[model samples]
Target: MPNMGRKLRVGMVGGGGPANFFGGPHRRGILIDNSAELTAGALRSNPDDAIASARDLFFTRGYGDWRSMIAEEAKRDDGIDYVTIVTPNDAHFGPAVAAAEAGMGVLCEKPLVMNLDEARTLHQAVKTAGVPFVVAYTYTAFPMVMMARHMVADGKVGEVRKVEAWYPQGWLAGSRESTADAAGQKQASWRVDPSKSGASGCGGDIGTHAYEFVRFVAGLTATRVRARLKTFVPGRALDDDFTVLADLDNGGVATIAASQVTIGAQNDNGFRVVGTEGTLEWSITDHNNLKYYRAGEPVHVYRLGGMYNYFPSTITPFIRVPEGHPEGFHEAMANLHRCLEWQIRAKLGEQVPDHMHLPGIADGVAGMAFLDAAVRSGRQDGEWVDVEPVG
Candidate 1:
């Protein structure tokens, strides 16, 4: 893309309040490339708190709510070029649709929205507006993850046969909602509340990550799913653990599972894709490396920076650091923001490369479809159910 010669202005919805753990990361990620500036925010639902939070973060302007921010920002010549949505699951649809309709690019956090219907609607809104849109499927932006996608597409793993992806987080293993202090309560409360977090909490929250990982890396699509959702915490309104068995489109099968109730597991997200020729494995725990296995050969471990020469030409430019330097969550996030920045510039008539490996509306809709299928199957006692054709 052509250099715009100036930083793009950014707005935000949610990501405010003292207890929000996600907001700061989004902010830090957006600024990491120095390609964008945080200009405005509807930081909180409360008017005064919103303004106070924005001021604290040094945002140029703030509004009482997302609607107002979108409305007012649309009228300004120096308005935000895009909006980053860090809101809860339930709040995603409205601001995302409104921002797109107002011609602002959207970078939204996942599970996209509460349901597949909302996901499609938001998808249409962005399509109609022709604004750059990105769903924050953060892991897909990791350098190793991108390399895996390249390898799979290059037929390095041959035809995928079995995919196993799992994410286990221990934060909600016990009753943190009732027993922990204020910050813990604030984080755990909404996630366990159906009205706020939507159906199948753990499934929608982290399970989608595993599902998306399989899709992005293995290039496989799940045609149907048999799932079991469990709420281990006695009074939790949503599932804290879930397992899904899916039939892949290529006559392969997949096992995707997630648990917030897994003791000693802290973001232990991993995936293994077995193909006709070999197996490719990755884990967020070792975010920078990937392991390739063959029956008669020793395992080949590829580190992020060291694999630059081995990565496809299309992806080598996205590798940000030197060899042996570690890149983690923040770098992955910044990669997403960098893609968004390039996309935003492209929307301004700059010529960008034809392919940018960032997740967009379709990926968002796919996530919702997976969640819907999983929930339906779980309700039917793990009976097989077709994934909705919505995206």
Candidate 2:
């Protein structure tokens, strides 16, 4: 807490070299609160790329490997208060576990690891280290999404009967020059590789985002699922399209789906929760708005601002701008980072609210369970698979 008035010093792991898809959003988002600084980075596997990224990001210096960076940074009096892991799936385990064991706070990209066991081990380490940790499940931090959660808890949607969620993108639609990615040329090339991305591709990537959205909004757990996963692209090692039917803990049901091969869909992530009284809808494409429907009333659209009479008062504090102007993905992520930063400050003896929380290790573990069960059910031809929640 010696640097209480200063920004939290942040060290980095891997993202991408030239420019990463994840790192930009994360850094932009965390800075939205002006709570953290990107003082150091180990941006890529190649030492040259890492150094180049450090220069581009204006870091104090770049190291060749995360272990070297972590160890050296730990020796500083103003050493990184936290580390951000933006590496790919296979690369997450070593650095994250090592950082937590080293007593540095960790905020990692999702899905937290390639497997649930890794998640459990990381969880244990964080607990023992007593450091704050979070997985970047960014969508849950959206203002409207939180409003949806507030509404569900308020029974604005009544008794939740069913939920439907899907994240469809057209990014992986066509054939790739197989050699281009192996030579480390383009973005997301590792996503289709089983060894690099994990067991299921589409479901593990965006599908888990949809799954988290459903649970976050509906405030219910899907204990089991019946799923089908498919790979449309030729010579692919994992799935690109997946659909799942889940049985909720409250006896409700959900249809969850995600696809990277949907032509023209373009990151269309959305969900609808149907309750006995009404239904709630939200889409990240139209992120600022949350639509609501009641049995005997007109549709109510709540924008992400205080001027809206329809929006609950709880949402006002999170609204950063005027009514018509929209808050976006960066803002959503910023909110999550803000919450996490507050928790870090609280840990450092600065007073902060107790109910402040974001998806942590248990949620990360549960996400792995979701992906694992989907793969298992897909293999067994749409059989039911149970999801035991974990961080």
Best by TM-score: 1
Candidate 2's TM-score reads: 0.93
Per residue, candidate 2 scores C-alpha lDDT tens digits across 247-341 of: 99899999998998999998899899999999999998889888999988999987777577765654554568878887888987777667667
Candidate whose lDDT is highest? 1
Cα deviation at 308, candidate 1, in Å, is: 3.3
Q: Give the TM-score of each candidate.
A: 0.97, 0.93
For 29-99, candidate 1 gives per-residue lDDT tens digits of 99887778999999997989998999999999978888889999999999899999998899999999999
RMSD of 1: 1.4
Model 2 has an lDDT value of 0.82
